[model samples]
Target: MTALPPVVDEQTWRDALADLLVREKAATKELDAIAAARRRLPAVKLPEYRLTAEDGSSVTLAEVFDGRSQLVIYHHMWSDGNRWQCSGCTGLTSQWTRTGALAELDARFVVVTNGPMDEILAYKKRVGNEMTWYSSAGSAFGADMDAGPGEGFAFNVFLRDGDDVYRTWHTTSRGAEQFSLFFAISDVLPYGRQEVWQDVPDGWPQDPTYERWLTSKDVAALYGDPEA
Candidate 1:
């Protein structure tokens, strides 16, 4: 091959890199605007529903917030019987950080699910996440939000002004993308970036392809002792 051209001067290289950084910042701003527009869309009204808590206490949707106008509900994908926990949910939950900023915005975040109170508590404790979690066992709230079993992952936001409650936003695809913030901030090495098809250094192991972890069990397993 012909000899390569002379290397560019440091100042020239820095100028070109600066220009690219400006463009990247502008692109990020545009993406943020798009996300803001999505959040501004109107929300459907949700009927008031009651759900049980992990403490064996009962709470209404509004009560979960401790008297706040907004709520961010994470439908944790936990199941009973042979289905002890959801890998995808576990993956997302493991990435959550309890930022006091959430409360400053007049909103509270919670993970609601049909899993038993004891099981949910055990998992939360094991994971070491401080985000509030609740059990929606025997409640229609989960079904109403399309977050029950057989339903895909969902992140939903609700706002209440007085007694009126409306769903402000909901997302299901690549919803766990925010988990990358940890790596972007250099807090932790990226783990599942492979899910985005991004290139990795040669010889690195690829991320697992399974959507959720499955427990070893047959169809008859559901009717037997659930905790066994």
Candidate 2:
């Protein structure tokens, strides 16, 4: 077994926790300040772009909001005609099983990919993904947003003002971690992700970063998809 944290008297443990709590509260306040600054950031109006819906129907970017004032589009990574999707993107997508609560906040969450609609739908079924997905095929929607075919993934936020749409924020890489409750929960565990990059006790287990990311096969097992 790996080494465990040293045992201490109850009062000593309580004192250690009190010290950590002080830092945790300060960090929380800093995060709140950051969010306040983010809200004050200016947004840019975007040009018109058409996207293909699940029914093969064409729709405008503004219509993606679905009558909501705010929209959050996860720019899913996809390889044209490839059945093996990006494991990282697939795992992150799987974590978003329930999004109905976001609607109460006047925000609609959906996914857009550069893959062809037909192939995307087929893959979605094979993986049992429930999130509403659209295809940017035959349009500049993906490229203009820096998430074209095979260009990686991103989370793009927008605001709708009647027929006009404004780009509010765009984040990729680790920024997308906000959507992953799995990561949030892992962070509180004793091993704390167990990744080589993280600081841990010398005897603790550690592996290369992302070495254990979930794959389509993992999702298939969870969802009971025979096709995977």
Candidate 3:
């Protein structure tokens, strides 16, 4: 355990908050500019990629667009011979279980993983996810698109134009955290994710020692696998 922040007078806290507002406003504007730039980034034409669904149905990358112009594929982390799922990937799915914006924005969002089709389906069922998921194993989709080596999480953006699919953008590792709201909320917590690496204030409650205590398997054990 670590000591909590000290209680200060209201006026003193107000002054500190007012000072922080300047930085917050600047960050907001900078982020807005970055998004604008991201929207303008050029896209690359994709190949004739084929992926399989949990039901063993064959689907093309363009088909994944599902008639939507914009498509977002969440490349979940799973691998062959690995029994446990990626904790970060699991965290992302757990937080972002559903979204109404897919239809509103003329977009379809799906999850993809290289894990065995059966294992992916079992994990999906265990997690109680309604989102459509696909297996990109033995497919160029994962290898060519930088989804990482079987156990890496990534958010890949795609665009569809009259039956042709194009790769717009993709982010992996810590950058993929943008797809998860848990990180944003965690940023507001006093401990701030409780990870060993964060440079939080001294004496803050956190796990300074790195360990595997927080992971997808932990989540599964705590929440109970729905399939089981």
**How does model 1 fare in lDDT?**
0.67
**What digit string (tens of lDDT, one per residue) describes model 3 on residues 52-153?**
976899989888777889998888877666656776677567666566677889998888887668888777766655678898888877878777464467
Comparing candidate 2 with candidate 3, which one achieves the higher TM-score? 2
In the range 90-174, model 2's lDDT, one tens digit per residue, is 8888888799999899999999999999998887887778999999988999988989876989999899999899998999989
Using all chains and alpha carbons, the TM-scores for the candidates as numbered come to 0.74, 0.97, 0.90
Best prediction by TM-score: 2
* lDDT comparison, 1 vs 3, better candidate: 3
lDDT of 1 by residue, 1-228 (tens): 322334799999899879989989998899899899987797898788887776679877778877889888888876675234665665565556655588788988888887778777765655554667888778877777878865766788899877678888877767645543533553233333343254554544455654223232221132223333
Q: Pick out the ten consecutive residues of candidate 3 with the lowest summed lDDT.
A: 205-214
What candidate 3 gets wrong by more than 4 Å, as runs, is 209-213, 221-227
CA lDDT for candidate 3: 0.78
lDDT head-to-head 2 vs 3, winner: 2
Q: Candidate 2: minimum summed lDDT over ten consecutive residues — where?
A: 219-228
Question: Candidate order by TM-score, highest to lowest?
Answer: 2, 3, 1
Clashes of each: 0, 0, 0
Residue pairs with backbone atoms closer than 3 Å in model 2 (clashes): none
